[model samples]
Target: MEYVVSHIPQGTACNRRSAYKMIPTTITIHNTGNPSSTARNERDWLTNPSNARQASFHIVVDERQAIECIPLIENAWHAGDGSGVNSGNRTSIGIEICESGNYAKTLDNAAELVAKMLKERGWGTDRLRRHFDWSGKICPRLMYDGGNWTGWKTFVASVDAKLKPKEDVRMPEEVAVQVDGKKVGVGEIKDGVTKVPVRLVAEAFGANVLWDAKTRTVNITKKEAV
Candidate 1:
C-alpha cells in the first residue's frame, strides 16, 4: 500500500531534491526508551529542547499511527555516529517506536510503516537493518534481546510482495508484425518485469507513446502506425 503520513506536519524538509536521491539504505529502530503517549508528543521533547540533543529520524510509530518526524532529505541526529553509512545520525533512517520499555505493540505498526516507506521510495529490502547493527546501543530491544526479529525480518520480506513489475512480452520473438502497412519488429527480451520502458518496445513496434505523469502511471497505447 502507498505510504500515507498520518501525523506528520505538512511541508517537512530533509535533504536536497535529486533525481536519484538515495532512500534509507538502513533502518535503525528504537523504542522511545521513555513512556510517551504518542510519537508527536515525543517529537516535542526532542525538538523543543534542541539543546537536549539534536537528533532526527524519518518516522515515529506509536500504538495507533505513524508520525513523520524528519524529512527524508535531512540528516537526523539518530545514529549517534557520523563516520559510518549505517550511523543513525547521518545516513540511517531512524524510526522511534514509542514504547514504555515494558509493554508496547508498536513493532507490528513499525514493520508495516517500514515496508510502505521503502516501497514508496523505490528502495529494496536488502537495505533493511536494525540500530544495533550501526551502533552498540541496544535499541529496538524487543527484536534484539527478546528474539523477536521475526517481525522486523518479516516486514523487510514484504518489501517486494506488493510491487508488481510489468510483464514483458517480447514482440513475437523471431516474427514481425504489421502496423499500418509497416513491418514492426517482434519479440525482444528485457530485464525485470512490470514497468518496462515502453519507449524501446514502442520504437521496435513502430509506435509512439505519450506519458500522463500526473498520476505517476505511464500511459502506453499504440504509437503512430506508420
Candidate 2:
C-alpha cells in the first residue's frame, strides 16, 4: 500500500493552476501504451512542466510500486473527454497501469492499488471503469490485444476478495469443578463437548477409584448411606 509521490505542480496544462475539488465517484483504468515506459518515467514526465500537454493521471502503477503524479482532489486530463464538465475528468480518479517489463506483475500491482483505493473510499467494484468506458479510445490496449477484455471481471473479483471480511475463530474455555467448597477438577469445553478426569472427581468426593484387571474397566466406590 505504499506509493511514491511526485506531484505535478499547478499552473500547467496537465494540472490546472486553480484547485478543483472532486468527490471521486468512479475509478478509471488506463494503460501507458508505451511498452518501455515505467511508472517512475511516467511520473517524471508528468512532473516536468515542459512536458505538460493536457495529459496527466492520478497514479501510474508498475511491477514494483505505484507513483502519484496528480492529486486525487484535482482533475487529470487522462480521459479523452473534451475540455468540458465531463464526468471522467471531473468526478473520477484515473489510474494508468504501466505496460513495461513484467506486465503481469504490473497488472497485479495495479489491481492491488485499485482495491486499496476502493476500500479507503468505501466504494464497490461497480465504480470501476476502463478508459474505453469514458470515451471510444482503445486505451489499456493490452487488455484488448491480449484478449483480456473479459478479464476485467477477474480483476474486479480480486478487488472484491480483498474487501471480504475475515472469518472469526472462537477458542474453547476452561471449566472448573468444585466439591464441598473446594475446587476438585478442571474440565475443558471443546466443540460443544466437556471433558473431565473421572478419577479426580471420584477422589474429591471421597470415593475409591479402582481399575479392574480382568474386565479392563474403572470402578468407583463410596460408603452407601443407610
Candidate 3:
C-alpha cells in the first residue's frame, strides 16, 4: 500500500497538463492500455520531457510496486473531462493500473490503493469513478470486464470490503470472573463494556452490601483493606 514518489518535474509540459491544484472529491481508475509496460515504465513516460500528451496520473501500480508521478493535491489529465467546476480532471485523484504483469495482482493492488485513498479522505465507495464514468473511455479494461457492470461491481466490492471497519469484539460471550485468582461469578458484556453482578463481586472483595429500601438502591462498603 506504499508508493515511491517520482513527481513530474515542473515544466511547460507538466504545467500545461497538471498545474492546477485539486481538492480531490473523487477517485478515477484507469488501465495503462499498454499491456507490456511496468508501473515504473509508465511513470517514466509520464514524467519524461519528450512526452507532450495532455495525459498524466497521480499514481501507477503494477504487480510489483506503485509509483506516484503527480501529487494527489494537483490535477492530472487522466480524466478526459475538461477543466470546469465539476470536471473529473479538476476534482478527482487519478490512478492508472498498469497491465503489464500479473494482471489480477495489479487489480488487487489498485483496489488496495483506492480503498486507502477513500479511507484517508473519509470517502465512501460511491466516490469511486471509472474513466468511462467521466469520459466514456473504457479504462482499466480488466475491471471493465467487456463493459459489464458486474465487472466494475466486483472491483468496487473489493474496495468496499477493505473500507469496512475492523471488528472490535469487546466480549464474545459471558466469561468466567475471578477475584484475586479465585472464581467469583461470571461477567457479561454489554455495549462493549463488561457487567458483573455487584453482590458477588463485592462480597468476593470482602465488602458488605447493604440495600437501601427507601431508595431501592444497593450500596457496598469495604469491610477490610486488602
Candidate 4:
C-alpha cells in the first residue's frame, strides 16, 4: 500500500522520537486500541507535543492511507521492551493498525504494507512479530481475539499469502545461434543457461569440435576464446 512519509521532527522530545539508529530486522504489528482514531489522527498525536508519551511507531495505517511517523532507519518507542540491542524497539519496524473505521480495510492495508516491506527486503512471513511477542501486552488484540490464537494465525496466514513469492515458469526458450553475424543453429535457453549444438556453431566459424563419448566431453579449439 502506498504510504506518505510525515516523519516527526528530529528534535522532538525523547519520548516522541529517539536518536537511536536502527536497521530493522523484523516487523512488529500493534493496534492503537483507541478504536476511534484514524491513521491521520494517530500520526498527528504522535507528533503533537501535548501527546507526550513514550510510545511511538513507524507507520499508522487506517482504511484510507498509511502515514509514516518515523523513518525505518530510526528506532521508535512502540515495543514496550527496553531499548537493548536485540529489543524490538531497536530491531523492528513498528506498524500500528488503526482500528477506528473500516477495520477489515485497515487490516488488508496493513497486510499489504507488511508484504511490500518483506518483498523489498527479501524477508519472509517469519520476520513478522506481534507486540505481544516483545512484551506481554496484548496489542493487536483484535487479531488475537482472545486465547485460542486462531485470529492471530489467520492474520499471519493472510500476510503470508501476500508475501509469498510467485513461481517462475522456467520454460526453455529457443535462441538462434550465430557465427560472424550469420545464423548458424538454434539453442535452448533454460535456467538462464543456453545449450546449443556446439559442433554446428564451431564448424560455421571454421573450427573443429569433437565429442568423445568415453569422456563425455566436447572439445573445441580456437573458435577464438572469450
TM for every model, in the order presented, reads 0.53, 0.70, 0.71, 0.71
What is the C-alpha lDDT profile of model 2 across 1-226, one tens digit per residue? 3689878677766444235776678999998989999888988776565773767788999988898877788777777785466568787889998888898788888888888888898888899988888887887787765555766666778778877876666687799978788888788898789888889889888788999999999999995766
lDDT of 1 by residue, 111-206 (tens): 667766677777767766667666666766655646656645554555446344647666432444445666554444434323334565676565
- Please identify model 2 stretches exceeding 4 Å from their true place: 13-18, 48-52, 145-148, 169-226
lDDT of each: 0.58, 0.81, 0.84, 0.88
List per-candidate RMSD values in Å.
16.0, 6.3, 9.6, 10.6
User: In candidate 4, what are the lDDT values of residues 1-226, reduced to their tens digit?
Assistant: 5689999887777566876899999999998999899988998887676875778999999998999999899999999999899999999999999888889888999888888889899989899999999998987888776766676787788989988768877879999998889898899999989899888987987787888999999888775565
At residue 76, candidate 4 shows an lDDT of 94
Rank by lDDT (best first): 4, 3, 2, 1
Among all windows of ten consecutive residues in candidate 3, which has the lowest summed lDDT?
10-19
Candidate 4 TM-score versus the reference: 0.71
